[model samples]
Target: MTKLWQQRLQRQQRLMLRYLRLVFNEFFMIAVFILLGGAAYSYAGYIKTLTAPLWWSRPLVLILLLVLLTVGHFATLLQAADSLFLLPQESALKGYLKQAFSHSVPLPWVLLSFVCGFLVPFLEIGGGRSLISIGVLWLSVLILKLGQLWGQVVQLYLPTTQFRSQQVTFYGLSLLSLGLGLYSWPALGFVFSILTASISRWRLQQVQQQHLFQWQLALNQEASRMLQIYRFFNLFTDVPQLQGQIKRRRYLQPLLRWTTGRTTNPFLYLNWRGFLRGTEYSGLYLRLLVIGAIVLLFLQQVWLALVIALVFSYLIGFQLLPFYRSYWDYPQQRLYPQPASRRQQAFLKFLTPLFVGIWLVFSLAAYQLWLAPFGWVIILGVGVFNVAFLKLYVPNWLKRHEN
Candidate 1:
């Protein structure tokens, strides 16, 4: 059983390493360092200005800590076939899960500790926490995280409805304990942590008596985690493993109709519908637009806001190029009456309005920042440039690369 677990772990690690290499390209690594530096500088500046904490500080921190501790699902590395092929090894599966949890718990604690330690200065300067108190709080968070991890394992043994209820109960108790711990009732928090740990153990024992392993549940959980990773990676590069996720999104149907309305060109229709159906493509565009708008709304510097907006516009245009090529995979698309020029036109037509809409959003945010005239010109100019670039330059560039 131990050997089996080790083999699975090594396989997962290899897969992770391959994806990690793809994720940390040189350009991405550089951008990450730049962003991290900017963040650290901003945080230091903000912390120095904090003479004292606001009333909401403790509760906000407590909530954030609770969320960090409670938010993740446990990864048991169990596959769907395990239920059938390894049914006889059910007892060993328990040991495997024990090992999994043992491996998983330390990383979150270490990360949480670093984050808490970093915020220690802020807690001291702003929230008036002593060193000893902070230490106690950190220890309490670690303990609660352990209980939460155990709770996640216990949940796999439960039916769907019961699992959800138990999850909610655990999160609520976690919040209460963290809140009490931070709000002058440290003893109560310790007691709650002990209680949660005890209850989790009791629940585990009870579930073990059934000698049942929920392989399907574990498989789904693991698959969901992988899909999330793939979705993020899909933003930067084509993730062939990614499966398109669609939502009916009845509310957006009208907009979809308006966009694709009675188009004689099949290429335009197919591309528009594909964008609407594929969550990855549409979600990426919307997320970048929102992020750009948020940066424009908050950052007092107009030039910085404009730069971010243009960068996001370029990203949106570039990313959507894949959608243009999506139809190429189907030989039927080749037989369509639409000419290649019309296909390119279709892509431009679909993307132009979307970029313009994003620009309008950013421009509105910029207007609030008192840069309306400059924002309008910058956004409009970029919007036009993006459309033209996507239509003319990108196709030839992609063809060259393909050749």
Candidate 2:
């Protein structure tokens, strides 16, 4: 019986991987995301520049980014199988997640901390204490990752969900506590991280000791759904009519109203309209805002403050590319006697960088109190690309294959 279930689980694992491989292929272009991501983090001068605006900004952004570092370990991989939910045997599902996390959580922190550790040394070159803090920061990242993984297993099989809710607060506090290590005493933060990690392991043991639930399957289906959506959108060359299925969020009607209704091109209008209304783009917006808030939170210098804004400019442009591509059916775009496909491509010319600029201006202003020497460089980059670059290239590229 155990052998049979194990075989079933193995097959399920392969299926999940296939789904994942397909999704990754769609996002191959977006692999460049790491470059922009590193650009913001690699520059501590930027973090310091943004921090001087508010005393709280540094700790808050740093803490939030730390938590992101921790959570990301789990986010990186897909679960092997979810059909365990529909299976006959319960025990296999119960402890499965524990094994998975044990296998997965350490990698993200190790990689991220290594990157962070190197960056910190360069950023805080003169301060020995700050260097020690960076070292502790690297150690604490692994501890936090382990602790959070343990806490999540505890959340799964426990009798009540309330305990899971408490676990979140615990994780938040751990990050908040860890941030202090970056300041006064690096050693103390390291100790606290160890202690918290111990508590998470303890919680997991308590669940095991009590035999509270049967097993842990690949239950985080939401993550799988997100990957699936990204995959499906990759299918159609034009905005697959079905793309609307992903964009329509009735809850966002109030927010959708904020997008200007004046554009004659409905696709252009809807692309902007949908971008604002959907939870997907809100997250992107939220992340930009969060980055700005962090830089402002830790605003200690002039030159570094606007880096968040600059990177966000790139992010906004990259994410909006799909929307720009979908603007073909915009009515104003069809005013001339052009093919429907041609009209759509033309509308994309204007829409692509418009969204990017909106986010860039808002993100940059938070740190704009000083004239960061890099500010004009960013503006010039944005203008040149938005005007001469994207407009010139996208239209021609679309024309090459216009059927």
Model 1 Cα lDDT, one tens digit per residue, 1-403? 7887789889988877777777575134443454445456667888989987767778778878977885555777777787788888777777888888887787788888987887787777777778877787887888888888888888778887877887787777777777777777777787887787777777777877764767787888888877777776666556778867877777777888899888887777777778887787888788767766765565554455556566666666666776767886678755655566777767767876787687678767677645444645556656676767766777786566445
TM-score of 2: 0.55
The weakest ten consecutive residues by lDDT in model 2 span: 234-243
Q: Residue 337 in model 1: shift from native, Å? A: 6.6
Clashing pairs in 1: none
Lowest-sum lDDT 10-residue window in model 1 = 26-35
lDDT of 1 at 205: 77
TM accuracy, model 1: 0.81
Question: Best-fitting candidate, measured by TM-score?
Answer: 1
Each prediction's whole-model lDDT (CA)? 0.73, 0.54
